[model samples]
Target: MSNTPLVQMIGIEKHFGGVRAVDHVSLDLYPGEVVGVLGHNGAGKSCLMRILAGAMLPNEGEIRVGGKTVTFADPNDAREAGIETIYQTLALADHLDAPSNLFLGRELKTRFGNLDDARMLEESRKVLARLNPNFKNLSDPVSSLSGGQRQVIAIARAIYFDTRVLIMDEPTAALGPSETAMVSDLIRQLRSEGIGILLVSHDMHDVFDLCDRVVVMNKGRLVGAHGIDEVTKDDVLSLIVKGELPADWSARNLEAAQ
Candidate 1:
C-alpha cells in the first residue's frame, strides 16, 4: 500500500429529517485495493457510498481525492474527479447497443463534431474483449445480452475511462454462480490494473474472494476495517450483526488454517 490514499472520508455525517442516516465515519480507499463495504440494511452502508458518489451530500465531512480535500457538488463533480459508480440497477439503456451503452454520456466525436458510431463500436469491442471475450457484438442492443454480459458493459465503461476510484453497489446481488464468477474475474482484473475500488456487498463470498480489505458499518457509524487475511467469515458475520470485532477475533490472530 502507498502512504497516500486515493480517496479518504473523514468524520462524514448526514441525515434525513430527524433520522441520522450516517454518523461520523472515517475510511480510506487505496490504489490497487478493493475495500468491501459490508452491513445489513439501514446500517448506513449505501448512504456513506452515496455521499462519496455524490448521489447524496453529507452535511458535514471531508473528502480527499489524491491528497487534496474536496467537496463533490454533485455526481458530475465526482465523475469529473475520475470517480465512477455502477449502481445495482446496472443503469444501461435497454434500447442502446453495447457500444452506445459503453459511451453513453461520453462519446467519441468525428471531426465534423458528430457522433462517431464506427469508432465507438470498435473501442467498445476492444475493452470488452479484454474482460469478456465471449461478450456478444457491440452492435446488439443491451437488452439481448445476458446478465453477465450487461455487467461486462458496465464495468468496461468504467475501465475504459480509467476511473481512479470505482464504487459498486451490490455488484453481484442477483446472479447465478457462473455470472458471479465472471464478475469476480472482472474485479480481479481491475485490481491488477491498480484502480482503487469500493465494493458494497452483503455476500461474504463476494467480499472474501474479491476484497483486499473489509470495512463494516452499523447504525451509520464505522464499526471496523480489517485486512482480509486478518479476519474470517465468522468474524465478519459477527461484525455485520453486532457492529464490532467478535470476541474471538483477536488483533494478533494468525489463523494457521488458511
Candidate 2:
C-alpha cells in the first residue's frame, strides 16, 4: 500500500434535524487497498460515505484528495475529483443499451452536435471488454441483462472516466453465489489497477474475503478499525453491537506487538 492516502475524511460529522446521523469520524483509503465499512442500519456508515461521495454534505469536516483539501457542492464535483460512487441500485438506465447507459449524462457528441452513437458504442465495447470479456449484449437494454452483467456496466461507467476512488454500497447484496464471485473478481481487478475502494457491506464473508481492513460504526460513531488479519469476526461483532473493542485489544498494545 502507498504511504500517502488516496482519500481522507477528517473529523466528518453529519446531522439530520436533532439526530446526529454521523458523529466525528475520520477514515483513509489507500491506493490498491479495500477498506470495508461495516455497520448496522442507521449506524451512520452510509452517511459518512455519502459525505465523501458528495451526495450529502457534512456538518463539519474536511476532505482531502491527493494530499490537497477539496470541497464538493454535489456529486459532479466528486466525479471531477476522480471519485465515483456505485450505489446498491447500480443506477443504470434500464431502458438504454450498454453504450447508451455507459455515457448517459456525459455523452459523446459529433462535431455537428448529434449524439455520436457509433463512437459511443465503440468506446463502450473497449471498456467492457477490459472489465468483462464475455459481455456481448451491447445492443440490448440493460434491464434484460443479468445482475452481474448490470454491475459490470455500472463499474465500467465509473472507471471509464478515470475514477481513482470508488465508493461501493452493498455491491454484492442480492447476488447469487456465482454473481457475487464475479463482482469480487472485479473488485480485485480494480484494486490491482491501484483504485482505492471504500466498500460498505453487511456480509461478513464478503468483508473478510475482499477487505484489507475493516472499520465498525455504531450510533454514528466509529467504534474501531482493524486490519483483517489482526481481528476476528467475533471481535468485530462486539464492536458493532456494543461500540467497544475487545478488552485485550488496544492501539498501543497492537502497535507494540507489531
Candidate 3:
C-alpha cells in the first residue's frame, strides 16, 4: 500500500438542525487497501461517506484527493477528482442495457453529434470482461441480470472512467452466499489493481474477510479504528454496540500512560 492516502477526510462535521449527523470525523483511504466502515443505522457512517462522495456537504471539514486539498460542489466534481460511489441501490436504469447504462450521462458521441452506440458497447464489453469474464449479456436490460451481474455493471461503470477511489455501500446486502462471494472476489481484484476502496457494511464476516482495517462508529462518533490483526470480531462489535475500545487496547493505553 502507498504511504500516502488516496483520499483523506479531515475533521468532518455535519449537522441537521439540532442533530449532529456527523461529528468531527477523520478518515483515510490508501491506494490498494480496503477499509471497512462499521456502524448502526444512524451511526453517521453513511453521512460521512456521502460527504466524501459529494452527495452532501460538510458543515466543517476538508477533503483531500491525491494529496491535494479540494472542494466538491457536487458528485460530478467528486467524479472529476477520481472518486466514485456505488450506492446500495446500484442506481441503474432498469430499462437500459449494460452499454447504455454504462454511458448514461456521459455518452460517447459520433462526429456529427449522434450516439456512438457501437463504441460504447465495445468499451462496456471490455470493462465488464475485466471485472467479470462471464458477463456476456451486454445487450440485456439491467433488470434482467442477476444481483452479482448487476454489481459488475455498476462497478465497471465506476472504474471505466479511471476511478481511483471507490465507495461501496452495503455491497453484498441482499446477495446470496455465492453472489456475495463473487462481489468479494471483485473487490479483491480491484484492490490488486491499486484502487482504494471504502466498504461501508454491517456484516462482520465481510469486514474481516475483505478489509485490511476497520473503523467503528456509534451515535455519530468514531469510537475505534483497528487493523484486522489487531482486533477480533467481538472487539469490533463492542465498539459498535457500546462505543468502547477492546480490553487489550485499553490495557496497552494504560501501560503507555505509565
The number of the candidate with the highest lDDT is: 2
Model 1 misplaced stretches (Cα beyond 4 Å): 251-258
lDDT of 3 by residue, 1-258 (tens): 879999999999999999998999999999999999999999999999899988899999899987899999898899889999888889999999999999887899999999999999999989898777888999999999998888878877887897899999998886778768878998898899999999999889999999999999899888898888777788889899989976687676557568
- Sort order, lDDT high to low: 2, 3, 1
Q: Give the clash count for each candidate.
A: 0, 0, 0
| Candidate 2 segments exceeding 4 Å error | 250-258
Question: Better model by lDDT, 2 or 3?
Answer: 2
lDDT of 2 by residue, 1-258 (tens): 989999989999999899999999999999999999998999999888889988998999999999999998898889989999888888988999999999987899999999999999999999999867898999999999998889888878888898899999998785778768877998999999999999999999999999999999999999898899888788888888889877876774568678
| lDDT for 131 (candidate 2) | 69
User: What C-alpha RMSD separates each model from the true structure?
Assistant: 2.5, 2.3, 2.5
For model 2 the TM-score comes to 0.91
lDDT of each: 0.87, 0.90, 0.90
Candidate 1 backbone collisions, by pair: none
